[model samples]
Target: MRIKVSLYARRGEVLDYNHCYELAREIRRAIKTVDPEILSDEASRLYTFSRIMVKNRSFELCRDGMKLLTSQLYFFFSSLSKNICDSLIDGFVELRRLNAGGISFEVSKIEVIKESKITGNEKLVTLSPINFRDRSCEDADFEEKFTEKLTKELIRRYTIIYGSNFDGDVRFKVLKCKSVAIRVGGKKYRAHLMVFNAHGSKKLIEIGYKSGFGTMTDCGFGMVKKAKRI
Candidate 1:
């Protein structure tokens, strides 16, 4: 399931570009309120979130960060588990305030985003980007390695969630991509923002859509949405 969270941020509030770490912390706090057990188990967090989608005006970058000339900020959150989504909604509604990287926001609305059916072949665009390599690693055949690792991870996560093996083959082709850097937990890492096509088991694709692709999804990486066209 996916949800669009609408937040009201007053003008003059600044948002750091690398605010994913802070946002993840606050989101976990909200989830902990409704489902403490989920937070306790690291394996239980099969979820990811998109970058803050700003609206209503423009912004100027300053020494501090992206200063808000806007009043509304939105983001999408998705989970493979319905229980997690339900708890997140309830927790956010109860608290109604969110603070990330020293920027304060009031929860304006939370709406469920209806998911479209996956027909086993889909064009996807990343909402938060994807990363699966160690910061020190370099390879000449990085793209091949990326596909191999993604397939293995998808099957692994599928097994964990459904408690069954996925014998179907998984395939991914990057139509276009660009390298990007993000900071998580105060550490910088390389990631990719891309448009890609994934074809294979519908369940596997659904898992990627609902949870995420690649690694560090729990820290707000690898959230994707189906694109009508690239």
Candidate 2:
């Protein structure tokens, strides 16, 4: 299931680019309010059960801070189960405030764009800048190790969510990876904007679409979306 939400800030309000974590927090808060049990377990909390995206209307830099000028924001949520999707939809409706950086907005509208299962042998995935790290050994080959780590992480997440072992070989090739910086909790971290081709089980790929890729998905990192062929 996939849902698109349109949000409108209260009059005279603005937002910042670094509000990704704040937006994710509001999403989780809303989901927990509707169905607290969804996050009761460690596995559930870690499971990439849903993926999100926040689209700003426009952006600007100012002395006060970076400002998002447009009143409207769009959010996309994707998952396998319609029930989970429905819960999120209801949660947004019941939400009192969509606050980010102390700024609040109202849910102007919500729409379900895709509710059915997504199936495809190959997919083009674009990842929101990912923080790929190797804390064990700083001397290791970063790119090679990062690729291996991400592959394992995806398989592990898929197994946990589906409750079935996916033995199929999951293959990924980074078509593009460029260094980028992201801010969270007032600290900046080096990350990468990656575009890749994934060839494997369609089900597994779809799971990544909803759950996110790499790590810190809940905090708005590693968000994945299908890319169109040019």
Candidate 3:
């Protein structure tokens, strides 16, 4: 559990800064409460007005440690998001410094990430409705049926993918899908699932389906290609 934090705050203007190592110590203490089992690498970083450059460094840390931070805090363990944790640490440290209240990590950036990508395993698989049935609507929806079996199969595949890789991952902390650009049969495919996939890469779909929600419009067979594992 290694996190390197750097902050830029005004001194008398709006800045109540403290020693760099001391700030790191406060962060270390706060993290211990968050997770005692953390294998922390470094300490808190309070970069005062003279050291505003630390912001860039903090951003890089956000990226490097994002995976671990998210896995331990957010989606997997339901602990907290990086922003939230940073905010908490900031507040805790600030309050102690001024014996006052209110402080924040205005912004942070994460640089570089590590993950496993299996290119050979990326293959196109087709699923279809085994049984044809009349499509029905849910009152608000227009009805047109193709194959219920196909829907079930898609759902099953979705469950297999999402249920397996997503909800069950103990090492994952955060799972945010930003945007996705997909095409089926040389046509652009726009949907929520695609959007999510666009946000984060392999993190959202390690060994599972991209979208847990079986999309009704997710038609046609397509190839599943993956990047080489790093």
Candidate 4:
């Protein structure tokens, strides 16, 4: 399940460039608000989110960061568990106010995004960059490691959700990719923003679609959308 959250803020509010961590922290705070137990449950943390998107090219670049010329921005969040999504919605509604990167905003609305049908083969594009553990794009074995890590992570998530081992094969091929640098906890990490083909078990693909790909998804990495064919 997924939801789009719209936030309204005053114009001229400036957001820092390294706002992902703050954004993620605010999301966790919301989740904790409604269901404190969810924070303690490891399985409940299997989720991903997109970067903050300014509406209508409403922001301009400045020395500090993006200066909001408009009053609204939004982001998408997804998870395999309906309980998590429900908790998030309730949390957001109850909290009302959100603070990210030193900027304050009000939660104006929340809407559920309909799921797409998953097949054995699907083209996916990242909404948030994909991060493989201890791997960067510059590594000679990056692609190989990416596939290996992705497969194991999906199976791990499956086991946690189903309480059984996943015996299916997982296949991913990057069609187009580029490196992205991001900071979390004052440490810089290299990730990838890419369009890729995912081919394997439909259940696994669906899991990846809902929960996201690669590692550190809960920290807002590897969120993906079904790619449209041109």
The numbered model that scores best in TM-score is 4
Write out the backbone clash pairs for model 1.
none
**Of models 2 and 4, which has the larger TM-score?**
4
- Which of candidates 2 and 3 reaches a greater lDDT? 2
Of 1 and 2, the candidate ahead on lDDT is 1
The list of candidate 2 runs beyond 4 A from truth reads: 10-14, 46-57, 62-66, 115-127, 134-143, 186-189
Q: Give the TM-score of candidate 2.
A: 0.78
The TM-score ranking, best first, is 4, 1, 2, 3
Q: Give the poorly placed runs of model 4, Cα more than 4 Å off.
A: 138-140
lDDT of 3 by residue, 1-230 (tens): 11223333332222122222232344445445545545232112111111122322322233212111110110000011343344445544543331101233322322212222422123221111111123222222211122223334443443543454323211111112222233333444332211111112233333222222223212311112222333
- Cα error, candidate 3, residue 158 (Å): 46
- Would you list the rank order by lDDT, best first? 4, 1, 2, 3
Off by over 4 Å in 1: 62-64, 134-140
- Candidate 3 lDDT at 114 equals 28
Best by lDDT: 4
Q: CA lDDT of each candidate?
A: 0.83, 0.64, 0.26, 0.87
Steric overlap count per candidate: 0, 3, 23, 0
How close is every model to the real structure, measured as TM-score? 0.91, 0.78, 0.18, 0.93
Model 2, 11-52: lDDT tens digits are 345455566677777877877787788867545555232222
| Candidate 4 per-residue lDDT over residues 1-230, each given as its tens digit | 98999989889989877677888998898888876778687688889998887899789999988999999899999998888888889999999988886688899999998988889999999989988646766677777778888989999999998999989967888788888788998998888888999998999889889998988898889999999989
- In angstroms, the error of model 4 at 109 is 0.7
